[model samples]
Target: MASVAFGYLPILLFLLVALGLSTAFVVLPMIVSRFTGAHQPNPEKLSEYECGFPAFEDSRAQFDVRFYLVAILFIVFDLEAAFLFPWAVSLDSTGWAGWTGMMVFLAELGLGLAYAWKKGALEWE
Candidate 1:
């Protein structure tokens, strides 16, 4: 147990130092601000700004379905691209099995893209 603790001593010391440094950084600014700052509040400063126009309605309004569809499509394609990196790195080691797996993955993605295209999800018009 002593030997185990000795092995972790460097990690423990690192954690303690990190905690102390972060606390100092956070507390020092707060202490300095208390000494230097005065409270000033105005109604105009608190209000949300609109593009040169006074807000006519509630800011939280319902969005269109197209925005969600585009977001989902972007996420799907982005995740597919992320998967490609690891596959590309180990291509030689993976051989036919990995190649077949990637082909299936790509085929599924292509099908999804085709479905979205047919549904007009990809169209801006």
Candidate 2:
């Protein structure tokens, strides 16, 4: 058991060194920047501006529903594609099980798209 434990000593040492180096890399820059950087503050420095337009607006202003609909659709499709990556990588080994699983997943995504379309979520007018 002692020999087995000794065999892993190098790996344990490497992990500790790696962790220490990573921490130092992150901390050193932060410490240096804090000491050397300018500590200046002004009202205009914090204001948000885009193309010379005032960026802030009334907090209670109503937003167009289409914007939210498009965002939701984007998230749904993006997640669906995210799942496809792992399935694609193991395609050769997964055989029919993977194919059927992906088919089901695609079918569900298609249903969601269809629902969104029928509900006028896709219409921009």
Q: Write the per-residue lDDT of candidate 2 for residues 1-125, one digit (tens) a residue.
A: 99999999999999999999999999988888678874345778766665675756797888998999899899999999999999999999999999999999999999999999999999997
What residue runs in model 2 are displaced by over 4 Å at the alpha carbon? 1-37, 49-52
User: Top TM-score: which candidate number?
Assistant: 1
lDDT of 1 by residue, 63-87 (tens): 7899999999999999999999999
Model 1: how far is 69 from its true place, Å?
A: 0.7
lDDT of each: 0.91, 0.91
Q: Name the candidate that leads on lDDT.
A: 1
